[model samples]
Target: MAKRKGKGPTPKAEDRHWHGKRQKARAAKNAKRTGTPTMGPSGRPTATDSPRPSGRPAGARRAAGDSPELVTGRNPVVEALRAGVPGTALYVMSGTDERIRESIQMAADRRIPLLETGKNELDRLTDGAVHQGIALQVRPYRYAHPDDLLKGTAPLIVALDGITDPRNLGAIVRSAAAFGATGVVVPERRAAGVTAGAWKTSAGTLASVPVAQATNLTRQLKAYQQAGCFVAGLDARGSTPVADLEVASGPFVLVVGSEGKGLGRLVADTCDMLVTIPMPGKAESLNAGVAAGIALYEISRLRS
Candidate 1:
């Protein structure tokens, strides 16, 4: 233990290009163990080269943001593995087909790991954007309160004041989980979380909704209008019309704004109704997740 004097030599042009790449990798592994036909280094002929397997495996050199990528698509990786979304990893790209290989074998029957890689290494792990070639790394989207959506069952909620993208907050949480709306409210300082191109444009609806982030969205829309609910506010200077808003009768709350400023005056005075979405053509507004899915399908056809 007393001779530790290492870090001392090899720098003359990296020791003559590391001894000419260690003698051309020992003459291409002795001409690939001797039928004598080697060439490569792009001079071609290593039997039309496409071999590649001499290195990478210390976690494949890991670094694209050191993981937590999730570049989404293919039904948001089968709805983020049927919305359990815990510990995910799923990468997929190399020749993906059979419905993205049955959504990566339903994210490997739920143990989640997947991996694959190729489409230019998943476009260099999602930096080139459009990860429609499917990409996922996982862990981040969590939010769920307002008393766990008031013990859920059809609560109807939406908020989103300063809607900062993330693919329009994963397509307004896949149109508030396809019309019945149970939870979603943003603005933890002008938002945009649940990434992976907003879960590939929320084809998985950010893994079965429940967003809640507010720090005081006009006092949680006046505490969802003192609990009896009904808070509407999608204003194109609305005077009611989201096909006559009511949103699934019972408990409601829909306030959409900030696509270049739409409803913010203490969140449109804690709305009790402002409604809009009647666009008689010549589009002026609609795309805050299609005006929050036409104001949550007019609050689910005024609660059936």
Candidate 2:
């Protein structure tokens, strides 16, 4: 077979400029002191001082959109391993903490290959993230289509609106799993995608729970309503208590949004009903994750 060609998309100029500015300044200063021109041997300006690629690995920040994502930092890596996020390889160095060794052992047990990389190379690979001498490369997540999650008898779906945090997405997925929901749906744009942080937060529940993306959240919720599912939007000002939402016994979809701003106006209008979680204490609002969890639990309880 002929050798492969084409390196891929051209990196931005900033990413290409890995050379230290101090070195270039020093070179210019020397040239000025000697009364000589500062140029490469070939007489081209900036030719001798050309920026070199970091040679960052595939999962690095430089290639984020590319398949696979690198889980950097020691605690995150260990959590990923413990959560059983499917990994392709473990890039690590020596003299790390006990957590690193534990992660290595986990990788070995799972038959995931360990490639010993140096500090500089690992830094380049992670795009300057604190890797703590260890990182795990996980396969790209395959998202389910919004309609694909509509299957199953009396399917229950959870739709998220403007929830940008991956950890919140993971928590919602976990609750969806616990409450026997069909799947979780998130807006395709301006929403969090499955990442290392989500994997760690889900504690591996994400492996079984599928997350679907919707191009338009309100439209998708309308579709769900047309399909005969009762759509409920969780908001602080809602008049209906989540516990009394007897609609959970049948086809249902619960929409959640950010805590600060609550649900978007369009999404709120799309829902068939609006439900609120009652809190008698001094607390004001719940986090997206916690709110989703409480709502899902109540819905589950009502269904049971």
Candidate 3:
């Protein structure tokens, strides 16, 4: 074979790749130098990357470790502390609350770090997420077993067959707390985890209710049923109407499925009875949160 010396000039495809990268770099540099915004790959200037005045005044972004960010207000931060969020840090506005006096005392006793800041400073740190004037910097949420939550009283458990929306989960938690439900059960996978958005959407109700995540939802339902709880699945096609269902004044569980697709067949089969909410309007179905709220409130009313 004839000897081929060194490789020739780079192929056109290779040249184009390097050229594209160089062009991107040059564009970014020009934008930085001229103080002109550059379009992103989607042909839009990134709102976050664009230079803008700090939302807070000077000294607002306090140096890290100067103090943990303040969690303020009455219910949220106090409930967070009471719920045993690990490593909670608290800051209260001086003389802002007399209602939280007991909560403040508890914080002092627990040796949770405490400081006082202006309401504006508290507002800056919380980004307006209902600090209730008390803010806590703590670890993420911790979930427990549904039965564990029901240890003392007959549990009113909300079992989600396939709820994947963080907002819906939050809303359900809020409703569960309002209706005095003991816990919320969700599947381990194909579902939304307890994230900040869910916590926030719960409007601080997450602190009030225990949440359980199950590896097998059907098996968990069976466990609840065996534990003397009535397992009811919410299905539009169910033979029973939620209003008409003869609910015993005992421990019960209600299951709500995912949006778009209804309950998984296995989960539906696990329920002792499937209940439906009657809708006479043009809408064929309800949002997961709304449906969950109705069922929870009805159960609460019946139990009471």
Best prediction by lDDT: 2
Local accuracy of candidate 1 as per-residue lDDT tens digits, 1-304: 5987799776775467578888879987886555355665866343222222121222111122223444356665566555554535666765346657777777778777665666776655554555566655565555665556654545788888878777788888888888868778786775675655566667766667778777778987887778777787888898778776545477777788866678888778768778777777997767788888767776777787
Estimate candidate 1's alpha-carbon lDDT, on a 0 to 1 scale: 0.66
Local accuracy of candidate 3 as per-residue lDDT tens digits, 1-304? 8987998787885467688888879988887556476666987554333322222222111112223333345765566456454435556666447646756777888896665656776665665545565555554456787667565456788889778777799899999999988889898778876654466678778877888988899998899888888888899868888776556357888899875787999988889998988888999889999999998878877787
- Arranged by TM-score with the best first, the candidates are 2, 3, 1
Model 1 segments more than 4 A misplaced: 1-79, 83-105, 108-161, 164-168, 171-173, 176-189, 193-238, 244-255, 258-262, 265-294, 299-304
lDDT of 2 at 69: 75
CA-lDDT, candidates in order: 0.66, 0.81, 0.70
lDDT of 2 at 33: 52
Top candidate on TM-score is: 2
lDDT string for model 2 (1-304, tens) is 8998999998875567654676678887776455344565666433222221132432222123434578777787887889988887888887458999999999999998787778887776676777788878787788899888888778889999989888898889988888898899998778888876787778888988899989899999999989888999999979999999997889999999898999999999989889999999999999999999999999988888
TM-score of 1: 0.28
Question: How far out, in Å, is residue 214 in model 2?
Answer: 0.7
Better of 1 and 2 by lDDT: 2
